[model samples]
Target: MTSLLLVEDDAVIRTSVSLALERYGYHVTTADDGLSGLEAAQTGGHDLLLLDVMLPSLDGISLCRKIRETSQVPILMMSARGDGLDVVAGLEGGADDYVVKPVDLPVLVARIRSLLRRTTIAQPQPETGQVGATLAFGELSVDTGSLEVRRAGQRLELSPTELRLLLEFAAHPGIVLERATLLRTVWDYGWDGDSRVVDLCVQRLRKKVGAERIETVRGFGYRLNTT
Candidate 1:
């Protein structure tokens, strides 16, 4: 059974969400505050983490950052507000995804499944005419077989989502990839998915790979600059 750690301060929400997730075949563990949540996360050996944004002691964003410093375990943040800033902060703080509160169980489960599915790094094939296990884009190199990424001879510490996003762009090199396409391909989101995830992930990827390597195509999408 897949185990999950849920850190939520609200007693009502904590109970309800844990019960629902258990019904969905997950082994669910709960924590009511951020500090305990962080502690449980460090020792729990959970497959994933469900974190509520507001919590006593540490807050979810800080906890997420602390966890990210050592582990790449998938994190999904829940916020009572759907404000863009909150979502951005959660993502920037190392969450793989975020869900607005008044939580919809079905949607939350879907997001959880998607995050878990991505934990296994897919071996991305290089584009036609490119013949090697390692795909090189100027200073950046992605070794598809070993699932390692390096920038200018230095290994980059990237989350699974970030590495997958980089691989998608590296495989297509120079070709524009629409946000919607990325939503489906990279995140496994259906047609009405939020583009913010794509944009934010791109921003994070650029910071590691260098901003100049990825070109924004105005109203189109994004392309990995091979020149």
Candidate 2:
């Protein structure tokens, strides 16, 4: 059975989701607050994470940021409503996807399965955890084999997920890649994959490699501007 980590503050909602997910053939481990969620998340055992954006103790955003630093664990954010800002924030915080409150169990299950598919595909070299054979665009250099990143002679240190994301973008330089496509390929995420994850990672990468390196296609996808 696929294992999952569910983090939510509301007791009733958490219980309901746990039950629903359990019925769908998932082993669910839940946390009531962001602090506990972060702790559980770092244990590094679960297959996917279902996080609520509005969390008590530490807040989901911060926890997400911290986790994104080292692990590429698929994260699915939950919000109270279909609030765009919250969705964006969750994505920016490193969540792979988001679902509005009053979640649809069936839909959520579908998303999880999709994420799992991507995850399994990415597991081709399951034990290696290495990628990005040779990425270069306009002086920016990334060595996936050695996990080395640099731009214009300046060395860059990025989180594991961020490095994979950059490699994915570099692999398709000049061609626009959808946000969801990036999520699934780079981060192993599925379901309602949020654009914010791409947005935030791009923003962070921009700050490092220069914003001009990444082009936003708006409503389509993102591309690396080698020129």
Candidate 3:
């Protein structure tokens, strides 16, 4: 059974979601506020975290940022407000994924499953290409096999999502990958409306990997600067 930490201020939500997830065979630990959630998260042993945006003491975004500082555990942010800014903030804060409030159990479970798969699935080496080769672009380098990224010989810490996005770009070199394609390939979502995840992820990736390394193509999409 997958272990999960659920942090929500609303008692009703906490209980209902906890019960629902338990039925699905997930071992869940609940917290009513961000401070406690942060404490539980720091203790570790959780496969994933379902964090609510609004909470007493500390907010979800801050808690998410705190967790990211120390751990790469998959975080799924939940918010009652479907505001674009909230979603962007959560993702920017290091959440692996986000789901709006009134979450459908099936959808939430699917998201959880997808995140687990991404973290646990081993990438098989491709035969045609230099599967385990490290690609270098200017001062930046990406090791495919180890998934390590470095700039000017300094190692850079990246989340699983960011690393995957970087690898996808490195694989194609100068190719301009469409947002829809990136959504499907990186996020595992087919909905065209889910492009924000791609955009936010790209923005985060640019911040870490350098903005100049990824060129925005105005209306088209984005391309990696190989030279």
Best by lDDT: 1
Q: RMSD, each candidate, Å?
A: 3.4, 4.3, 2.8
Task: Give all candidates' CA lDDT scores.
Answer: 0.89, 0.79, 0.86
- Where does model 1 exceed 4 Å of error? 122-132
lDDT of 3 by residue, 56-94 (tens): 999999999999999888899997755778888898888
Of candidate 2, the 10-residue stretch with the lowest lDDT total is: 118-127
Q: Is candidate 1 or candidate 2 better by TM-score?
A: 1
lDDT per residue for candidate 2 within 1-227, as digits (tens), equals 88999999999999999998898888999999999998999998899999888898988888888888888788888877758888888777767666787898867787677666655544424346556476778889876565577889899866445666677777788999998888777655645465566788788778878889999998998898987
TM-score of each: 0.92, 0.73, 0.91
Q: What lDDT, from 0 to 1, does candidate 1 have?
A: 0.89
lDDT of 1 by residue, 129-202 (tens): 66558888898888877678899999998887888888889889999999999999889897668788889889
Which stretches of candidate 3 lie above 4 Å from their native place? 121-131
Q: For model 3, which pairs clash?
A: none
lDDT of 3 at 148: 74
- Please give the TM-score that candidate 3 achieves against the real structure: 0.91
